[model samples]
Target: MLATVIHAARDIRVEEVPDPELSGSGADAIVRVVAACVCGSDLWPYRGVTPTDAPHRIGHEFVGVVESVGADVEHVKTGDFVIAPFYVCDGTCVNCRNGVSTSCVQGSWWGGSDRSGGFADGGQGERVRVPLADGTLAVVPGPVGDDEIPGLLTLSDVMGTGHHAAVSAGVGPGDSVAVVGDGAVGLCAIIAAKRLGATTIIAMSRHADRQALAREFGATHIVEERGDEGVAAVQDLTGGIGADRVLECVGTKESMDQALRSARPGGMVGFVGVPNGGPELPVRQMFNRNVGVNGGVAPVRGYIDELMDDVRSGAIRPGRVFDLELPLSQAAEAYAGMDERRATKVLLRP
Candidate 1:
């Protein structure tokens, strides 16, 4: 099988790799990937912002059909369509029970070694060996059509992540909301804000295409300016008081500061962007206003079932963020398009 490997900065290649199989505990499963995509986080490594110690597999978000399951796996079986969250966790762990599955005691990630020291292939490949199979995989009732695959794939990461940001910020019915960043996750945040009944959604974006999509996804107002200008724009839309809840989807000092400043004195900021440049919280600023900040790496597994319902029912189309699609063999091109900002998100078919 062929899988994507990042050798170094700006170097991405698809090369033949070993096929995955069940592991010793019979707690693993092998999934034949139907679709996978590069994430904003993946770009950190691609752009050399995040150092690559050694060549390794890349990619995290994916959805596929179960090719096989281990002896202990019970919730799903062969041929079931499933969404694999970016992180692998034992569902019964204390952290998982508390709704923070990403912190599960036995949690691990794809494109890396499993807890047992065995290889776990990345999602951007022909197949993957899923750890904690029973706890990690969420079944998507099928027979699902090709048209629905992209939307379902979003449940693997971005859609669930966007939902986490909204939930953390305590976005409620009739509340005004602001979303920072206009990437796939940010656009999905707009969908989540609307789903949570936020009446006023302010999307901060300067790109024409993203701005159009933000409106389609439920952003009632668009603020093209950034920094102080952007914060002022959001405040003006909200009667000079700022948004009641702010969702920060970009992980940068600038974006974090913007999110914190764009909220009303009592508003909360929910952030999910993977930290690239260290972003600090000003104690005095947060104290002066009654503002609060909450959110971290999204525990997407916990939100999958609920979000999947909406995806299945066509209540939301978060997959619209995937504006580009290519074959698995063209993995290099997919990375380039995203790095160049030519595609909001790219989907790969194996």
Candidate 2:
């Protein structure tokens, strides 16, 4: 099978690799790659921010069809269309039971293990094996076509993460929410805020294209500022009180500070950006304002079902986040497009 292999920084290639075999002592499922996406977080590995000495397959968001199942797998069967969650969780764990499976004690991240990933030898290929199938894979209702695959694939990661961010931040009816990012996940956060009943969604974006999408996703206002000016704009939109809830979708220190400063006193900030640079928290400011900060790596597994219903009902069109599409063979191009901000999100068809 041909898979995307990252042997070093800025060194991603599509090459033939041995297919993965089921060897884990748990329910397993083999899924044929249908639609997979390039994530902003994937850029970390691509740029050598994350260590990878050996050739690593790099992908986590994907939707596919089941090709085979292990003996213990019962929830799904061969031929079933499914979306694999980015995190491999043991559903019975304490965190999983509480809908925090991303922090599950036994959670497994796709593509980071010897087990390979859905990116190259995984979902970016013809097929890939999914461990803990009963817990990690969700079967999509009805047959999915090419058009619907992009939206469905978002449930595997970005869409769910965005929803989690909005929910955690306590976005509610008539509330003003500020989303601090213009990437796919940030755009999804805007959509999530809208779905949660926020009336005034303030999207802080520097790009016109992303700002336009933010409006489409229900942002009532767009702030094309940064630093203190960005925070002031958000506060101005909220009548000088700051947003009722702020969704921090970028993990940098500046983004985090913007999120904190953009929220009203006693308000909540939900952050899900994978912190890239070392971001220091202004504890004194947070304490003085009594601001509630809550966020972490999104546990996408828990929100898949609810989000699927919204997608199926057409209440949300998360697929719009994918502005570029390429064949799996051109995965490197996909990465370049996203890194250069030429595309909001890149979808690869295997």
| Reference-based TM-score of each model | 0.99, 0.96
Q: Per-residue CA lDDT of candidate 2, range 207-278, in tens?
A: 988888899989999999888898888888888999999999989998898999999999999999988877
Model 1: residues with Cα > 4 Å off, grouped in runs: none
Candidate 2 segments whose C-alpha is farther than 4 A from its true place: 24-26, 114-121
Which digits, one per residue and each the tens of the lDDT, describe model 1 over residues 1-350?
99999999899999999999888878989999999999999999999999999999999999999999999889989999999999999999999999999999999999888899988899999999999899999999869989999999999999999999999999999999999999999999999999999999999999999999999999999999998999999999999999999999998999999999999999999999987778678979989998999999999999999898798788999989999999999988999999999999999999
How many clashes (backbone atoms < 3 Å, residues ≥3 apart in a chain or on different chains) does model 2 have? 2
Using TM-score, give the best candidate's number.
Answer: 1
Give the clashing residue pairs of candidate 1, or none: none
C-alpha lDDT of all candidate models, in order:
0.94, 0.85
